[model samples]
Target: MPSEIAPAGLRERKKEETRRLLLEGAAHLFKERGFEGTTVADIAAYANVSVRTFFRYFESKEALLLPDGVEIFAYVEHALSERPADEAPLDAVCNALLAAAKPFSASTLTALSHPLEDIENVITARLVQAFSDFEERLTVLVQRRLPPDTPDADLKAAVIACAALSAVRAVLRTRRARRASGISDTGPAPLLRAFGILHEIGSPERP
Candidate 1:
C-alpha cells in the first residue's frame, strides 16, 4: 500500500513539474524562435518530454499559450456568486472584470513579448481555437447571472464577451501607447479607465 501511494504521489508531482517545464519552455521558444517557428516537437524537446506526453497535457499549441482561461472563468464565477442577488448583472460583471483585470493584464504582457510578426500566422490559428473555448466558458458564466426567462441570453452573453474583451485589449493598447510616449505613470489607470468604459457601455441604460 505504501509503495502504491508513493508512486501516485510521485506521479502527481511529476505531472505538475512537467506542466511547469512545458510552459516555461514554450515561453522561451516563443521569445527566441517566435511562436510560429516553434513546433510541438521543439516544445517537447525543450521540456525533455515525449511528443505523446505533450498531447496528453495540451491538445494543441494554442492551449499552451492561453492556459488560464478556465481559471479566469472560475474567478469570474466566484466573483458573481459573492454579489447580492439584487445586484444588477451588468454591475456584477463589471466588478468581476475589475477583479480579474490584474492577472489577465500580466499574462497579456507576457504573451505579447513573444515575437509577433513571425508568429502571427501560428498564433492567429491558435487564438481562433482558444477564443472559441474562451467564449463558451464566458457564456456559461453570463447565463448564470441572467434571468431564467431572459430573451436572447446567447446574444447578451456574446455582447458581454465582446465588451469585456474589448476593454482588456483597449487597456493593453493604452498602456503600450503610454510607454511608447514616455509617460511616467506606473499606476493601473489605463485598466481602470477601460473597466469604467466597459461598465458604462454594458449598463442597461446604454440601450
Candidate 2:
C-alpha cells in the first residue's frame, strides 16, 4: 500500500510544482507587461504549460498573479499561540504578524508590483474576504489576553485586530508604491518604520 501511495504523492507534488511555476510566471508577466497586457495564454506559454493545464492550477490569470497569503496566516496562528503570555495585546498582534511575515518578507517585497489598480476588482476584495474569518479568530484570542477589568474588551479586541490588519496593508502598499516607481530595494527600513508606527498606534499619548 505504501508503494502504491508513493506514486500518488509524487503526482501531487508534480502538480504543486507546476502550479507554483505558473504563479511565478504570471507574476513576472504581470510586472513586465501590466495586467491587461498579459493573458492566460501568455502565462501558460511562459510556464511551458498548456492552457488546459493552467486552468487545472488556476481558474483565471488574475488568480495566478495575486498571492493567496495562506502561508502567512498559518504562520500567524502558530506565532500567536507561542507568543509570551506577558506580551501586550497590541504588541502580540503586531509582532505575530511581522514574525509571520519574516519568511516571506523578501519575496513579498520583491513581488510588490502594481498593487494600486482596480483592474481586478475581486483581487483585494477576495483577499479581504478570506482574512475576515482569521481576523475574528485572532480578535477572540487577543481579547482573552487583556485584563478582565478592561472596559469595552470586545471593542478593544476588534480595534487591535483591525489596526494590525491595516498596518500590514499599509506596509505592503508602501512597498508596492516604491516598487512601482522603480525603487531598487526596500531593505529593513520599511520593517523598522512599520514596527515603530504599529508599536505606537494604540498606545497612550506621550507626555
Candidate 3:
C-alpha cells in the first residue's frame, strides 16, 4: 500500500470504481483474445455490466484499451497542483503519480500483465494524440523547483520528466510481469525507490 493515497470525493470514488471494473474486464478479454478480437459487448458481459454502462465509462471499444488516457493524466495534473508548497517539485510530481497508481487492484494488475506489445502499440499512439501536453506539463512542474540560475533548466526539466515517466511505466510493467509469475509483492516500496532515484537525478547541489 502507498504511504499516502490522495483523498477523493465520494462521487468521484464511485465513478473511478466503475471505470476500474471496465478496465479490468477489458484487459482480461484483451489478454485472452488480443485487442483486435475483443468487442465492447464482450467486455461489458465479462464485467457483468450492461453495454450502456460500458458506454458511460468509455467512448469506444478502442478507448477501453487506454483507461489511463488523457482524463487520468489531467487528474494527475490536478494532483500535482495540490502538492504542499514545501515539497520538492520533482517529489511532488512523483508522489502525485504514485497516488494515482496506488488505487490499482489485483485484478487490474492481472489485466495489465497481458503482453504489452499490442496494447502498448495502441495506447502509445492514442497517448501521443490525446495527452500531447503531458510532457510539457511535467517539464513546467520540474523546472519550477530548479535553481533560478541553473543552466538549461528547461531542457533539464524535460529530461527529468521524461525519465521519471519512463521509469514509472517500467515499474508498472515490471510489477505486472511479476504478478503473472506468481510473485505478489504489490507494495509501494518499488514506487518510492523509483521516484527517489528520479529525485536524486533531477536535484542538484546548492554549493
CA deviation > 4 Å runs, candidate 1: 1-18, 30-37, 50-56, 102-105, 108-117, 136-140, 147-157, 179-189, 200-207
lDDT of 1 by residue, 119-176 (tens): 4466656555555676677667777778888899888877776666657556655665
Pairs in steric clash, model 1 = none
Q: TM-score ranking from best to worst?
A: 2, 3, 1
* lDDT head-to-head 1 vs 2, winner: 2
lDDT by residue for model 2 (80-118), tens: 888899998888887787677667755653333333354
Question: Per-residue lDDT of 33-142 in model 3, one digit per residue for the tens?
Answer: 87778888998888778899888878898776555545557767777778887786667778887776666543443233332445537755665555357778878987
What C-alpha lDDT do the candidate models reach, one value each?
0.69, 0.73, 0.70
Q: In model 2, what are the clashing residue pairs, if there are any?
A: none
Candidate 3 at residue 145, lDDT? 73
Considering only N, C-alpha and C atoms within 3 Å, which residue pairs clash in candidate 3?
A: none
Cα shift from native, residue 10, model 2 (Å): 10
* TM-score pick, better of 1 and 3: 3
* TM-score per candidate: 0.64, 0.69, 0.65
Order candidates by lDDT, high to low.
2, 3, 1
What's the residue-level lDDT of 170 in candidate 1? 67
Backbone clash tally for model 2?
A: 0
